[model samples]
Target: MGMDVYVGPLTRYTLGDWLTVVQQTMQAAGREVRIVHAEPEPEDVITDPVAVSDAVRSWQAGLLSALGSPEGWTDEAELPYWTDKPDWDGYGGMILLAAYDEQPEFRPGTRRGLLRRESRADSARAFQDAPAYKRASSNPTKYPTLLSGVEWWLPVEVAPTVFEAPRVTGQPARMGRVDQLVVELTLLAKRLGLDDDQLGQLRQAGPPDSSTDVEAAGRFGLAVFLELAHAAQLANQPLLLDY
Candidate 1:
């Protein structure tokens, strides 16, 4: 699977708070939610509400402790190592399984699992290929290849206060704030004829013709991001993204 990136607003809330948000969001939509523990015992699922909440709270604290913010944007030495399973000293994965009446096997699995699954399905990038800075901002443009679509100005360099992830690991991680994300996204969105009305339509209709044009793909990816950014701005949170 290719890397998929996401940009949204960040929240001051700890992982525990986000879990509560997830639970409440799911419940309000009228879906069944369960927490699964897959070790110490052979069991794969835990339906008890209290047990799940406690486990999630403990894991959140541990995760926060393990992840201390990096001091500088381009300081590669400060990047944090990543692991597939950050269970906070637990063998079992803390998963949130959801299902509606029509869909039974709607298992998103662990929070990270859900992010990875969605990124794969969506094909979003942590950073778009467009130039992050004006042509004059960097070195001379004599070598056009240096500004290839694959390259980008690190979010930390452009918007350090917003991006909190220590580094870009293989998995989803925080990148930049919504205000900066929107600004970067707008560069491509405007060139592709994606105005407010079009963005709104794309949000409603989902991604359209994303495979045909790079700008279109960026536009499609931002459809969800616009909403997420708005939510983050309201909640006073920073954006999380990876590619």
Candidate 2:
């Protein structure tokens, strides 16, 4: 019912194996860690380093092929992963992005009348009043980077043709670089009174306020997205906005 953001390998096999490696590595380092795979694997299959390495290689190759052999795409050497299922639904996500598009200086409390608890009619009116770029349309160019995709955001370097590639589910996906996403999110965090250090600390913080107040929802959604973007940057992984 809400967005489930994941920062990790794009392919199922790669993700499962990568998680296996993470679990083993952490356990070996005297830390208790357990990782649940996004994709379920057979209980009989044993995932080892060799399997993980092969899976990663195959994932990289498939991505290269899908992107038509784009130059300068490097395979990452490290895996830093993160995932979170925020409480905001798809509409909430769109509204938050649209709000940001309209007002980049969005704060927790502002009399801009952009954030308020609303009835169903009021909500629909708010959506209608959003900037033209954020509305649903067949013209892709009308959408901003954050609102372009309903489901996926690839970690590949920004390229004009990258947005044209099909998602793993065979649907159209969005293209964005990790650095670009991080920049946008960092700005939003600063508007909320969080600096780089405080923003990074959000990874360990509890969930944001869940009141029906639109401003609160927007802040919580932004925190979730910012955290995911940071994770994607660190892991050199795609950002999957799973519904």
Candidate 3:
């Protein structure tokens, strides 16, 4: 299967909000939401438009919660981005949180914050350890253009991804600062195999696009990754990857 990778924090909306979105989306597709009621002796397949809508909505809500709610912790199965076979979870062994609507802040007590913190420490340490030390970009000014599509986020208490659908065709969705950082990290981790010294050079060098050396290009991304990690921790957001 082809993989689509997304890096960002969860959205902060309610379960009802997502249910509404599901209904609207279904309606727009000219399909009515439906479910079967299997109680009270006779098992019946529900198709009354309003009843079907309500039944499907209620069912979806249950599914959302059973999976994961931003309001509470979910088993790995409930986590939106989690799969038995994850393509990547190498962010310093931290349990990455995918979006849920209820909780707006990063969950406490995880090593997810280590990457940025380490990057920051490395930045300061490098210069002190060596006068001419190059450092990764601590605070990058811009982000490379992300792919054009509906970006997703976890609404506050919802388990489903909220699509940030573009208003105009071919127009790109804007990513949050932390989201940008997550993407940067994902790319660097996947593409670069630099040592600490190379990373230090990347820190001092500019963004990847400007670099001619192949490794430096990768390092540019690593620099962005470090900055994003710092930003994620500062904002109390999780660095999540969706593949």
Candidate 4:
């Protein structure tokens, strides 16, 4: 399966009217608020939106605090909107990471091989041969920045981790900074020789002809990510990577 990106309130579609009511309450309060509820049953169809909102806010607050609460933080009442759906899977993500890993500029303690050019097949093989935990991005926490963590409602700022609480059921959960991710993604796009026009074309382009075209798939995935990251940054909303 592929990944779907989103930026806005968490689970706004699924909770429906319940989410609306809770969002209204949050807006009216004009300050941080929390709602408590009993644990839900396994077969429970309708979840308590208040509890969900509370969990989301609690997670956001803790993450923001950890992030030092960068500028442009806000509590806006906006519905969740689909950003982009990349035609790639976890392995595809690994492929992108592998490509970045091959770049000498991105590597640590070395500046050699800056002019080297490798094929997409080489990147695919690199991913296949490399260990699971590869230093593809400049994340201090060693997490795969864009494809794994969640970007909160704040301006772009880098951090090791954002959220401390358990993951929200189906919402964007892992904490991340949109700005730093943009920097990393932009670097990757440049390394692949993908310009703005090329990125836009790749964003609309279909998946690669062969899954073996790992570099093409990686470029397509990067295009989708850059679009969504920019949107999330501009809107000051959370960027969800729904797998």
- lDDT (tens digit, per residue) of candidate 4 on 105-139: 44323334575433222344244332222443334
Cα deviation of 174 in candidate 2 (Å)? Answer: 2.9
Off by over 4 Å in 3: 1-162, 165-187, 195-197, 208-215, 237-243
- CA shift at 32, candidate 2, in angstroms? 20
Please give the distance, in angstroms, between residue 99's alpha carbon in candidate 3 and its true position after superposition: 24
Candidate 3 — what's its lDDT? 0.31
lDDT (CA) per prediction: 0.33, 0.52, 0.31, 0.53
TM-score of each: 0.36, 0.57, 0.26, 0.62
lDDT of 1 by residue, 1-243 (tens): 112222221111211123323345688999855534221232444444455545434543443454442322211211221111111111001000001101212222213434632322212232221123223123323212111222112223234422233322112343333455445445434544568788778667644443433234444455554555454444433343221
Distance (Å) between predicted and true CA of 115, model 4?
18
> Worst lDDT window (10 residues) for model 2?
117-126
lDDT of 3 by residue, 1-243 (tens): 211122222221111112222345688999876422122222343434455444434543554455454442211212232111111112111111111001113222213445421221112111222111211112122222122112332223443222232211122333233344455445444444555566557556544342133233334544444554554444444343322
Q: RMSD of candidate 3 to the true fold?
A: 18.6
